[model samples]
Target: MIAVMLEILGSALLGLGLAAAAAVLLAHRLPARRLVLLAGGIGALLGAYVTHEALGPGHVLVTLLGSLGVSAVVVSLLLRPAAQAAAPAPAHRAVP
Candidate 1:
């Protein structure tokens, strides 16, 4: 059980790192959400392939879905603050 948990955790972190790096590289060319989604999707497919090769064919779908979810969450957590910081401040209105 502990080994399984560790594997999942490791997979998630690996997916998160890969997605985050891709998103960063694509940040200037795409919207934050779109970049994140694209990166996460790519990470999912890659993770699935790796897991299938490493752990056999039975685990591909599960690892793909898990990596997708983990990547999305990590990307959002990473980019949200940066988005908020980059947003323009609201303009002040003149008093009536």
Candidate 2:
């Protein structure tokens, strides 16, 4: 339907614009351009998915899974790298 198509197009454009704006703002503060881009991309993808799912008829589990997947992607990307970076390296021990 034309209405559905228009809705999707609108949401997609909004998602892209918001994501770009977020990434640009983050890039100003964050040194890792890649990480900010990753965050923005994930956010946009998730937003689009949520919009589509909300507009269409879908099962509850499917929506929940989609949302959960998005959350996992974002949380992992943001936290895992920082955790790895924060861990202290073990000191070299001389063999007896």
Clashes within 3 Å, all models in order:
0, 0
CA lDDT, candidate 1, residue 45: 49
For candidate 2, what's the RMSD?
7.2
Q: What is the TM-score of each candidate against the true structure?
A: 0.39, 0.38
The residue ranges of model 2 lying beyond 4 angstroms of the native Cα positions read 28-96
- Provide the overall lDDT of each model, using Cα atoms, as 2-decimal numbers: 0.58, 0.50
Candidate 1 structure quality by residue, lDDT tens digits, 1-96:
554555456565666566766576756544565556565655554555555456754464566566666565545554533333466888999999
Clashing pairs in 2: none
Residue 38, candidate 2: alpha-carbon lDDT: 55
